[model samples]
Target: MPDRKKIAVIVAGGSGLRMGSTIPKQFMEIGGKPVLHHTINAFRHAYPDIRIVLVIPEAHSAYIAPLLVSFDAPPSITIVHGGETRFHSVKNGLATITEPAVVFVHDGVRALISPELVRRCCEGALAKGNAIPAIEVKDSLREVDDEGNLAVDRSRFRIIQTPQTFLSEQLLPAFGQPYDPLFTDEASVAERFGAEIHLVEGEERNIKITRPLDLAIAEVLLATNK
Candidate 1:
């Protein structure tokens, strides 16, 4: 694995409408730094030499330089303009990978990703070809449909997280397939392309920052970790 390169395709294309902010949620401040700052930091913390491909909207490209400067981010980050959907954005990022390597597709807003979890995903992918981090569902669940809703077994389901790591041979070709709405994350894309999905233990604190409450939780977690 030492000879192989490690790359992270970070998707930060959210419009932030849900967060009710003019700035994209990924750029919003969290723990005295932007959400994306912490996200990229986590990967570097895990593997310093890992290459970064950051996908964001073309209009927001101007913000990247300043954000990087504010945190003194590494200059190795490759910035690409996002496409119409998550699937397309990821494909655009994947195009940057011309060689086979270990790739991680992550949500830029998930600022709480730890170095330990990132290493777990990397090791799993190296051994199994693909690794998706997930945790058990703790809340009650329901199956809703045209028929009345019914209780479903929460224990049977797991809540997925990132960075969804995979070998380049499997991950790059997976994105070459035609986009589908069901392609929610890298694991799904790889699975549809015939790669067996492997799950690794994920930290409960590795939560995506989507709302104000999530930011609060991140602050507390960051403080405690410090």
Candidate 2:
């Protein structure tokens, strides 16, 4: 098989409003390092020579250079200004990539993504054109229908996570269409343009840290991993 370049787009545009912090949630410290540090490092560990693009708010871009230096960020890392919404932010990150390669779009606050999971996403994408990581929902789920609430079968629904990997050709054209409110994640955006994506088993430990309790839980998970 011909070698394909690997690119990772790490979105760090979170405002931290939910976490009750002045800074973005991805900048919060966990285990004496920024949460984004753990996330970027995971991709670097998985694909040592991969090119990485980080998208963050313009106001927060200045702080990232020093933070990246402190962590010795991947040699090919690039920092770009984010847009008004998640869709636009992702567009800006995608703009940095200009090759026919596989790309992984990941949330910066998801600091617990393991190297093995990273490889699984990229390799899956290589074979399937696109790959989305998802895990079975373990909790009971409910939904409000037109008439009233209903207990939905949790077994039928899965909790989706990142990094969502895709072949650049399959992804770029799909993103060419105008953004929609329902485009909550990369997989949705891809599917919005009629692209078929495969789902890979996501690791249970892979979680997005948004609330204060989530950061605490991530701290414990990090300790356990060590």
| lDDT, candidates in the order shown | 0.89, 0.89
Q: List the residue pairs that clash in candidate 2.
A: none
lDDT of 1 by residue, 1-226 (tens): 5668999999998867888889889998877788898999999999999999999999998789767875664557899999999999999999999998999999998998999999999899989998899999998999999978999989889999999999899988888899889998888888899988999998899998998898888989988984
What stretches of model 2 exceed 4 Å from their correct place? 72-74
Model 2 CA RMSD to the hidden true structure, in angstroms: 1.4
